[model samples]
Target: MLRKITSLLLVGLLLVGLLAGCGAKPEEPQTEEPAKEEALKIAMVTDVGGVNDKSFNQSAWEGLQKAENELGVKPGYQESKQEADYSSNLELLTDAGNDLVWGIGFLMGSQVEQAAKDYPEQKFAIIDNYYENPSENLLGITFKEQEASFLVGYIAGKMTKTNKVGFIGGMDFAVIHRFDYGFKAGVKHANPDAEILSQYAGAFDKPAIGRSIAESMYAKDADIIFHAAGDTGNGMIEVAKEKGKYAIGVDKDQNPDAPENVITSAVKRVDNAIYNVAKDLKEGNFKGGTNITYGLAEGGVDIAPSSDKLVPKEILDEVAKLKEQIIAGEIKVPANKEEFEAMK
Candidate 1:
């Protein structure tokens, strides 16, 4: 009877062990859920001026930054250190499956066209340039930079204490030349005797060269220097501060660290263009294979105002009147040098 009782106890122990083993099966491996995606994937390929050139590229990037913050986009930008990088930089963004890609300047026209063609499924927008035969996936944005320049140039012509103003451009490109002739026309209109000095920096990112040219202009009694030279323009601003003169900004309202020296900015709204494109794309109103040109009538370009000892109330009033005239078709602004010369 003792042996039988002990065997029953051992059998009971074995059964309990088996039940414990079955209940505690090996733990399974853990997995994590995927990350949430951004609303839209947006990318930009900048010209050689880079993203922080304090002018054109910077203005465009500022718009992209705003879109990322408010428009629900995953924004990315690639800076081209040289002209040769434009195509590859575009390719990098396009290959990443970006929903919308933009090329910042007219300098990027060719590369953007090639990229849009290479990736027929991709969408592209270029500023200040339109393709002769734009692909179905490409869009172009252009501004009446000349109109804006004319406004500021008018002010410069009136504001120049020395009866001399200058325009320094980045590269001798057609766009820069447009700025030149329109400004010349305005200067001629406002102060018929005001001498206009114009030169090209031969490059977009050279502040030193820009500063040197501006200094030369200042030495020659150019009291106001208007620049479309990217960071080169920033240098001109510095020189303006040094000479206690005035400078004009472009592509953005660049009052700069020394706002007092800037009489006003001849503004071109690259920011608005980029921001609007993103907004349109998100709203399903993206227009591909099209060109949208903006002028003062469309709020795409205008002149910035200044208060601290540069422009007087009367001058601002005059500028405002002129702007109205331009908007209302009372005045015709020139788009190119030839047109401006003809008007003269």
Candidate 2:
């Protein structure tokens, strides 16, 4: 009887061990990690004026920054120290596999075109320039700078205390010519008796040259000066402050640079253009191989709202009417010296 009882206990222990083994969980199979989406890269190559030109180049960078802040894009830029640096800088950005690269000024048009051809798979854009037959990957961005320049010129014509106002330009290129002629037209329209003084610094980076030009203009009894010179215009503003005269700024609102001296600014909305293009790219609706011109009607260019700080309300009211006329195509502003001469 004792042997039979021990055998029964052993059988019962074996049954309990089998039941525990059956209740154990099986091992789980492994899974690969999910892939993350890649970020879109955008970049620009600045002209010889450099990135902080406080005018054209600065405005373009501001636009790119806006896109970066609002569109989640990886934005970058290469500042060209000299004209020769444009191609290399653009090449560097292109080789980095950026989703889009921009050439900041018309001065880089040929270089940008060459880069676009060399890197057919990459996309490119240029500001203030257009090609006759561009590659499918290149987009041209232009603004009606003349429209905005005319408005400010009108103000200078009406507000000049000495009946003489001055216009200073950079490089004397077709682009700068637009600013020069438009201002002349506006001045002629507003004050027929006003004498307009014009000069070209032949360089956009030399402030000393700009200062000397401004001094000469002021000494000749010119009461107001409008400059389309990039960083060089900053010198004209400084001279205006010292002489207690007024200066009309360009590209961006420069009143903050010298509140007492800057009566107004001709604002070209390069920032808006940059933001729009980036948004279109993000939405996969980008239209390459085409030139788009932004004008007063498109809100691409206009006088700074801060004009009210120094510009009389009556003058502002007149400018507003002229703006509408420009937008409506009633007032044709000249884009070149030939057209201006014909209009006169």
Candidate 3:
């Protein structure tokens, strides 16, 4: 009997050991949360104006910064020193494995077209110009700058005590042409007799030329000047402040830079467009091979309201009413020289 009991005890101990080994959970299956997705990488190739022109390039950089802050993405940029640098800069970004690359101005349109073809798998976004034939990986963003410029021009026409307004452009491109024509149209719309003098600096980054051109306009009795030049616009604003005349800004709300002279700014919201494209790309909803246009209706263009000190309350109220009309389709703003001529 003692032998049998000892054997039973040994058998029970063996059974308990087996159960414990079997129920040990197999080390929790060494499970992991399925490695997190890697962050997206984006790059921007700035136009000849560089990054700090306080215009389109600056706005585009702001958008890239926004993406870095909100999307957990990495951002990089390369500045193009000249037209020849466009292709090489794009190649550098592509070689760096950038998931998306942006070309920041109309001057980059041709380079973007070629780059898009060279890298069919990589995505590209171009501002201010849309390719007639785009690849599946390319997105073209165009703005109705004239719509915003017209509003600012109307304000200039109403505010000018000298009955003379001037337009200073960075270059003689379609983008600047729209600004010039739109300003003239707005002047005419507000006061049929208002005279608008226009000139182009021939270069977007030359502040000296901008200042010289503005001085000429001011000499001719232009009390208000609208500048679409990049850094050149800064020079124009500087002259306006020194001359104690009103200056209209472009691209962003530049009133803070020259508060005493900047009555208002024709805001292009370039950063907003950049942010939208980046956001869409991150969400895997990027739509390419198409041109996208942003207008007052889409909140893509407008006049900055931060210059209340320079723009009187009456003018602001009137501008607000016109903004509503434009959005409601009750008013159609001219966008080009032809449309402006028709309005005249």
Best by lDDT: 2
Instruction: Kindly report which residue stretches of model 2 are placed more than 4 angstroms away from their true locations once superposed.
Output: 1-34
Runs with alpha carbons beyond 4 Å of true place in candidate 3: 1-28
- TM-score for all predictions? 0.88, 0.93, 0.92
Highest-TM-score candidate: 2
Clashing pairs for model 3 are none
Candidate no. 1 TM-score: 0.88
Writing each residue's lDDT as its tens digit, candidate 1 over 1-344 gives 99999999999999999999999969889999899765898889988888998787988998888998998888899999999999999999988989999999989898899898899999999988966668889999988878888888888888888999999999887788778887888898899999999999988888899899999999998988899888877888889888888888887777755778887887888988999999999998888988999999998988764433568879878888998988898878887777987888
Candidate 3, residue 179: Cα displacement in angstroms equals 1.0
Task: State the lDDT of candidate 2 residue by residue for 60-175, as single tens digits.
Answer: 99999999899888899999989999999999998898999999998999999999999999999999997888888999999888999999999999999999999999987888
Which 10-residue window in model 3 sums to the lowest lDDT? 25-34
Better of 2 and 3 by lDDT: 2
Q: For residue 294, what is the lDDT in candidate 2? A: 93
Extract clashing residue pairs from model 2: none
Total clashes for model 2 = 0
